[model samples]
Target: MVDDTSLTSLPKCCLSVVIPCFNEVERIQQCIDRVLEQPVVGEV
Candidate 1:
């Protein structure tokens, strides 16, 4: 189980992963896949 103190120590900051595209229906899956595969190194 994750400790409450460790969770509370996390910084309050936004982690934005902007996927800018006009028509991203096809590429959206790939974008989401890549984003989800990435590990949260710092804030994200």
Candidate 2:
């Protein structure tokens, strides 16, 4: 198995979050807004 120490030293990279939704218009905005609030999230 891989060691956890090695993973911690890895360089940071851009993150992409994909939210596939159907008939979620009412709460989609809220979900996107919460994701955007995260410091590591560049886009939603």
Which window of 10 residues has the lowest lDDT sum in candidate 2?
35-44
Instruction: List candidate 2 segments past 4 Å from native.
Output: 1-11
Instruction: Give the CA lDDT, 0 to 100, for residue 33 in model 1.
Output: 78
Error of 2 at 27 (Å): 0.9
Candidate 2 accuracy as TM-score:
0.60
Position 40, candidate 1: lDDT: 55
lDDT string for model 1 (1-44, tens) is 89998998988765678778679888988877778776752432
lDDT winner: 2
Candidate 2 C-alpha lDDT tens digits along 1-44: 87999999999888888887799989989989989999998654
